[model samples]
Target: MFASVFVIALGLCYCSRASSQSSLGLPRLFGPSEALVKTAIEMNCELLTFPEDEPILLQLFREGNHSRLFAEYTSLEGEVADLPVYVQPYHEGNLECVARAQNNSLIEPTVSNIHYLKVIEPVKGAEIEVRSGSVDLFEGNMLELRCKLKAGNHVSYKWLLNGRLVSQSLLHDDRLLINRTTSQDSGSYRCVASNSFNQTDFFTSNSTEVVITVREPVKGAEIEVRSGSVDLFEGNMLELRCKLKAGNHVSYKWLLNGQLVSQSLLHDDRLLINRTTSQDSGSYRCVASNSFNQTDFFTSNSTEVVITVREPVKGAEIEVRSGSVDLFEGNMLELRCKLKAGNHVSYKWLLNGQLVSQSLLHDDRLLINRTTSQDSGSYRCVASNSFNQTDFFTSNSTEVVITVRDLVSTPNISFTVLKEDFQNYSAVVTCRSTRGTPPVTFSLYNSTEVIASVTVEEQFATFKVPLILGQDLGFLQCQARNGDNATYSEKIPLEVVPVGGPVKMPYTYDSGENYDVIGVTFYCKAEKGTHPRYQWFLNGTLLDDRGSFYYVDHQPPEMAMLMLSVGDSSAGTYHCEVSDSFDNTTAISSRRLYLDKHTLNRLPVWVVAVVFGSFTFLILLVSVCCGLGVVFRRRHYGEKSLLDFEMERMTPVYYGKLDLSHYNEDTDVVNAARWGEVDQASLDSVDEWPQIEEEKKTLEDEPAEEP
Candidate 1:
């Protein structure tokens, strides 16, 4: 080993490129080779201490700490460099160690030819880790295991599977890299790092073994959405089951168009839609995951379950895709039907409220192959479909106007200067036709008549108009006429901002309530003309700049801020006048400041008296009505009781009277008259009337006749 290392070091000693600065003394001991020194010294990176009494094997190593950059390194003299040599810690099998010759310039550093080798050994830690392989493995997967410590001189690596020496030709090196691992490799694996000081003396480290398990791939993973629903109309419930034929150790998730379904929409292995709406129409999928035999979670998705939720088509909106009502003749046009929240199956096209052929409605878009002037009418789109096979739904219709122009392409309009002035202001509106067939005429029109016209053979035309006599011009238009196909662009309102006028600033309009005391400031600006003046007056009296309660502050650019503490005396009409010294013209605007006065419950005598009198009258009327009602009720009940008693007494007495049914006609009539006419007041008097004389005479005279 020493002879081969010496030969390799000699072969690698030649310096590749000369350094910009003079290098140190001849590449000697205690440092790297001449090639490595040439690269490292220019980069200003220090050289680490070499192991004493060992052959210069030039081992390439990496810091085991997994960070963005392993920025820590120790030199022979315990020095460090700012620019660290970067290395990948995870990929460890074969690495190319390159030394970059860096300088203090911003340019890229020149890199040296990289020397390659296997990663050095790790330190003796008490555990085993997968340095270059996954922690968990499956059948038919390649795996590599590494010892935590690298082998030194007289050191060796031995791998054991469940405490038994694994016998394989591929385990010659210190690495335990395996390809297509199977269940035979699944055991308690540990790396036995043995160090030998002499031929007879050796030692081994106590490393905790790592267990590896392998599982077979799932068989035929799929999902099925079984539905028993037919009446899937609005307000109806929809039921579906996400059936899977995967392993039992799988976790399920319901996804609606790649988005995880909300908790309310998922119930265990089923998707239960409580109420179906128009928005629920989409593709659904079932995703499952299994992590038993893998390092990270592995997932599989089922096929999409397409569903259509239906509702009544209530309304629709029409959108002209070309964004123009007036289209050039012999051009393609498109109109879209923006349907409301509904599930529609078919559509019908209409022209001027009359139904057109169903063939005209194509792809939710009404495409006019070649529009002509005859097709200039109101076009309507009627969407018709049913929520279900058995139920019927109302169709929605929307209309828009489409005027197919017979004379030109739409013109491009722009104004050079759009400004208004009471004096003289000239502006121009230019019309350009870059795509139209030219020999076109451009016309600028006001509200009523065409005011300016220009015929141009070129692709552009301009029309100049005066803003005098009327600064308020209506919407201006430009028409480009070519042959019999002329069309004007959309109307452009020529809004000219006023150049100079009486200055106006936004102000507050708040009405003060009673008992409110506030200090408000009013501002008047006059920057229109030179040498302007500002004045403020309250109720026809000029307020002087006297006290703190009433003061005026003059500011830059011709503005005055009048501050006033408004109270009862300050509540009056105020006017602010601004005058232009150059034009001798003044503009005045007035505002009223009124603070309501507080009153202490003052009411009119007549109103109070009328209210009190009305209340008293209402009380008396209610009391009298209650008393009369009670008295009337009592009298009515008393009379009813007397009548009932009289009827009951007469019933018994009449039955005890003589038998009047056997009487003759004359006698019956006479007896009935006598009985009915008998006075109720004389009934008690008849028994006591002249009783003594009649009884005595009857007894003596009729003694013989009695036998």
Candidate 2:
């Protein structure tokens, strides 16, 4: 091992382009062969000292850490410890540390094994050198970039094109090689040199950039949309760029449907169409070319990319597949929305102006598995597309009314007797259904035979038929049908009532002693009858006038009542005549009703006169009291004097009733001041007054009674 290491070191020294500096006194060094720059390193020799002997005069030395030749650096005496070696531009040379004896001829100087010091400096000053003077490259030519360093050691090279590390296949020891290059290889190229001084952290340096322009015939050309998609809608902006996989200094031309588009429609290499319309939709491509000479150019056509421009949806209308507005219960319903013009449309259903069930909104046609009454409503459809993310381009279909009806429910039958003869009876039979559509047909059945049928817009239908007495209107049934379903009422039997009786009055009539009775009810009924009619007679005359005199409340198959409002002439004979409406047979009451006279008491003339006179005297007395009270109130509570009251009493000036010419205004004011009862302004405020002396004469003619 020692001999081989020595031989290897000697060969390395010879192989080095630059010579290494060595310390002549030091022997072969024994230490680590590799180290970091500016980091301490140790070199020692195998020299020892005994307790009984003097320490050997050993020292350490280092060289070849600098670029200068024959440059040697040494350590102090007895400095046989670890020798730290610092590096400069030059590194990776030999280091020697020698140990010698104090005094002994037999003990020669000790020499250590060769210590090869390899100082790894941080990489710096990295620059890429293009082998070709100018990087104006052509297709099918080789690309070469040499990474050089101004000051670094043990560095590895990496090539980056456009700031990305190049493939390892093109890297060869501080150089990048690309043979038969294409336009894709043309970009800013840089070389990175890196080395680790401590094997833990790597120091890296990037080279100056070099750009290569590789010109070639345009190939693998294509058009790309700036929005990453070629689909567009009306009013949308379209921007398409021509891209070439292998080309340089190329000009672009756009083509639509194999037709060359004008250059005015293009912006540089891009074709821009603002507010794209349906007319702009077609197969689009681009041709790329480069002119090498004034008249020579290489051209290539790109692959076509079909573009689709959609039109906004509009004028939506709903159509019912069943072709009818009304639908039966449990029927399948289908409705579709049709558009006037649109593309790529999606539809949704709205029922009664609200969005329908989410589980049914999957397609243009709304399909129902089974329809019910709950599904009856106004139906509409909305059409939209991806053109409007906010649904502004959406349209609503015109409303289509849909009516889902239920099957006709069980019919209900009833009978009402209109009239009847001695043998045949006329009756109205009605049939109805609670749940059904209108325009229902109802049939009346007697013993499984149709007696009558009637169709009406209402849910119910009525039929009038004649029945024979003592015969079966047998098992009367009513069937109601509306559209697809029919329902029947339960079978019923009809019975005929005959007129048999000695008719009698069951209830009593009371007119009592009260002369002022509002009404008196007289009731009469037969022993047995069918729909009996009654007539009331007063003094042998039929009381047909149902005016204020009487009201006849009669219920067939029951009793008939006569309510008489007592009037001056309502006192006389009263009787009820009962007759069967079915047979025209009549019967009279068993006994007649005699109503006593309800006469009002008469008053004497003298008594009426006394009452009238007493009322008039009382009214006059009250009026006189009211006037006197008002005068007293004005004299006390009001701000008026007694003279003012006297003046008011004497004044009667309307239509010149009072003759005020005999009175003087001045005499009135003098009298007011002398009395001290009225102010002059109060006396003057009175418009007129009766003659005072004449009024005094009239008062004197009246008798003066006690106060």
Candidate 3:
């Protein structure tokens, strides 16, 4: 077993040496490496290793050729490593080479797939062409074009019009078709192609130009005028119109100096005019255009217009004329005025240049009745029209002045007394001139002397005259004057009378009294002179003449028989005034009569004495009885018989034959009878009374007187 082990070891060494030589060293180490190294070798190559003591080598080969040694090398550090081999042809005639090392390491060569390289020629010329060759086309026509590329693969193609790229069919296919071209479709055309290598190419045919043309406009178009120039008066109407070419599809526009006048489309083209005037004149034009490829234009020229108007004329005039030669004061006068023109006329009566009445506009004549100085001013007329106004004045019209004469018409004078008679009294005399201008003066004449005068500013005048005792009575007159026109009212005559003395009384009378000597009538008369008429007043009322004297048949019981009551009205002034036929007056005398109360109360003395004596007797009787009663009573007591006898003896004897001749006849008979009877009784009782008294004394002691 040990011998076998030695042999095994030796064999191993020998194999190792051979493997190393073949793989790592010279060409002969591997058996003639002749092969064509083709890259088409299966699955490429592999690597190998050499033994420890071996060296390394490389071989070159071709497909179907002998392999040749290319290089050799010793293994570093006595070790072997594989190196790669290569083949040239990738697929066909597969060739390969291997490198070996002394250590018996080997490696197969790497191979590559073969790619063929082709050199392409640059593009020589390109062309873009439309189907029709030229680009002149109508609107809505079809257009087709193509771009041809000379050489290249994987090339991109783009079509262009007017320098802008357009869509094409596919990559490198340069054809463009545009259907229904319009005006916007006109332009030049070109194309471009590009490849993956970023290589670019451009081709432009001689510029293909297309233009879209519009159709011409048709005939039968219309023209319109808007707000045409016109000369219109203040109250006139204006109209405008549109003119047309008169065909189908025709429309109109109204323009004012090239601006659209209204928003409404005008179908009818005519306008109307009414109430024409001068202001409706100016230039007017019309425009006509259509949709059929025609140009629009205004009318060749404008038209001009003119107008004229007129105004109204003519009016009226009036004149006034007066008739009458002389105008008398207080006389009615007449004046006439007439409109002269024949046109529409109006009449107005004017005083002092102002319209007087609401007269109508149709009257031709005017009459003024009862004319006065107020109607004497200038008179004229006014004429008017639509165009002018004029006023015409009368030519120097005559003015009439009234004349007033002193005709001595009766004066209407009213007189009033302001105070009672014989007092300071005033008289108001109003004298009026019924037909005079103004400035009337009134004169009041008392007989020959003028008492008062007054001037008046108006035709009527009033005169105030103061009258006192002994003033004269006269006539009064009022005269009026205006320039030369003088007039006088009639004279007024006044009569003055004196107030009378108080009434005297023969208030009582007996039938047997002497009528002539006793004068039973009392005289009472108003103091009178000249024209003064006597009027007796009783109790303030005038007394008419029943007789020459006012007689009282009997006296009043309580009042004096003849007495006069006097007041301030008595003993007034008196004047005698004589007036001629013209009422001129003259005065002759003036007197005033005043009487005292005693003289007026004188009457018969017997009656008075009787009444007075009776009254005295009565007074004395009453006094003596009242005062001497006591004294007489004492005396009679002391000397009663003596006094009685003496009184009895002294008592006068009375006889029944007492004569009536002893009594005054004027004395009342009844009173005389009473006295006579009383005396007679005393005489008859004188003797018997004492005897009877003595006897009675003898019986007195016996209580009754004996008879």
Q: Candidates' lDDT values, in order? A: 0.53, 0.65, 0.39
Question: What would the TM-score be for candidate 1 when compared with the true structure?
Answer: 0.20
Evaluated at residue 253, the lDDT of candidate 2 is 85
Go through the candidates in order and give the clash count of each. Answer: 10, 0, 64
Steric clash pairs (candidate 2): none
Q: Over the full model, what C-alpha lDDT does candidate 2 score relative to the true structure?
A: 0.65
TM-scores of the candidates in the order shown:
0.20, 0.35, 0.20
The ten-residue window of minimal lDDT in model 2 covers: 673-682
Candidate 1 Cα misplacement greater than 4 A, ranges: 1-220, 223-298, 301-358, 361-424, 428-442, 446-463, 467-707
Tens digits of per-residue lDDT for model 3, 1-707: 43454433432222112233232322222221222222111122223443344333333343444433322233333323222223232222333444443233344323222222212223324566667444555445677766565654333566666777665442235567777665555666666554432133332223233332322223433333333333223222345554433322334444544455444434455444433333334344444443433344323222322222222122333332434434434444333433343344334444444554443223444454544555445443333212123322211112223232232233456564444353456666776666544455555555456566666666566777774434555666555445444445556656444333332222222222222122222222223322222233343444444424332222211111222222223222211212211122332222222222212222335765898798667656555554454465557468566445434323222111211222243444432211000111321322444543454245326443222
lDDT of 1 by residue, 462-541 (tens): 87776532245678877777766566767776654422464553233222343232455667765453334566777767
Between candidates 1 and 2, the one scoring higher on lDDT is: 2
lDDT rank, highest first? 2, 1, 3
Worst lDDT run of 10 residues, candidate 3, spans 671-680
Deviation in angstroms for 684 in model 2? 86
